[model samples]
Target: MNANEVLLDAFGRIHEAVAATLQGIDGDSLSRRPAGTGNSIAWLIWHLSRVEDAQVASAGGLDQVWTSQGFAGRFDLPLSQRDTGYGHSSSQVDAVQARPELLLDYYDAVHRQTVEYLQTLGDDDFDRVVDTRWDPPVTLGVRLVSTVADCLQHVGQAAYAKGLGRKPD
Candidate 1:
């Protein structure tokens, strides 16, 4: 498979895992924090979506789907339009309460944008430097991989939190 195809497949898995992890979860459960620490499932999902939206938009030189698509308004989050849940405090995490559907909708929107952006990139585009702050700088390929890694981590956290919220059968 080509690079684009590989990225599409990896991103597709993330989308599928998101839906599976959130399936049948109620709003209260989605927002529940395990042992009242760390992030809730809702926060994790939202943060993942936000990070993807922000980074993909930057890589594509396009507006973030969050603000452009009115997701910021739809969420009405206490945080600013620029917030991506980075270094969010416990109280900030607790503030991100939403139903599974909303979380999924936002994620779906961001994922769509990411796919569209990826479709526009040539293999050479991935080698373009997108960040210079790192010691070796960072390429589009590295940025995309990092975004995927972060999303996977958060999704796994969400899955674990979902399991914790479940009552013993």
Candidate 2:
């Protein structure tokens, strides 16, 4: 398979996991914090989606779905427009409250935008650097792969939290 196809499949897995984990979850379950301290299912999914949205948008030189597509207003969280849940505190995590439908809607929107941007890239595009802040710089391909890994991790945590039901309070 080609680079683009690999990325598509990777992102598809994230969406599948999210859908499976949130299939029958109610609002209370979604916002419940694991062990009463960890990230909630809602926060995990929302943060991952936000990160993906920002990363893909930056790579494509496009507007983030969170702001351009109206997700920021829809989410209505008490965080900055550019906040992606990085370094978020417990209060910030609790601020993100949503039902499964809203979470899915936002994630699906960002995913569609990401897929469209990725489909426009060719093999050669992967070699193009997208960031210079790192010591060796970052390539479009590396950034995308990093984003996939991060999203999978967060989604996995959400799935575990959903299944654990050990201390979601």
Candidate 3:
């Protein structure tokens, strides 16, 4: 498989894990930050989506969909504010799950945009090195893998917090 295909598979798996983990969680459960933590399921999803959006935007040298997609206004926060700490109120959690379909739609849009950006890249684009706010701003391929890893890790956290099952340590 090609680089884009590999990235797509990684992204798809992470999305699936997030969806499955959040499927039956109610507002209370979603808002609950595991003791000593400050991130709820809702916040995690929002943060993850924003990260993906920004990563794609950076890769494509274009603005991300945070505002264009109406996410900032809907969430009453700036796209630049990426604090994923817990401390979510019940209302916030309720709002997130209220329109589950919309969340899924937003995620799908982000994924499509990312794939499109990947398509625009040549072989060298994937291998080109760059600096990012991330610990090690590496090649585009490394960034894609890192993004997927971040998403999957948080999804597992959300699942474990809900007592669904112990996410792999």
Best by TM-score: 1
lDDT of 3 by residue, 94-115 (tens): 4444244455566767777887
TM-score of 3: 0.75
Give Cα-based local distance difference scores for all models. 0.90, 0.93, 0.67
Q: Give a tens-digit lDDT track for model 2, residues 24-120.
A: 8988889889889999999999999999999999988999989998989988889999999999988999999988998999999999998899899
By TM-score, the candidates rank as 1, 2, 3
lDDT: which candidate is best?
2
Model 3 regions more than 4 Å off: 36-38, 78-99, 132-137, 164-169
TM-score list, all predictions: 0.97, 0.96, 0.75
lDDT of 1 by residue, 1-169 (tens): 7777789888888899899988899988888899889699999999999998999899789899899999999999999999999989888999998889989999999989889888887899999999999979999999999999999999999999999888899
Clashing pairs in 1: none
2 against 3, candidate with superior TM-score: 2
Clashing pairs in 2: none
For model 2, the stretches where C-alpha displacement exceeds 4 angstroms are 166-169
Better of 1 and 2 by lDDT: 2
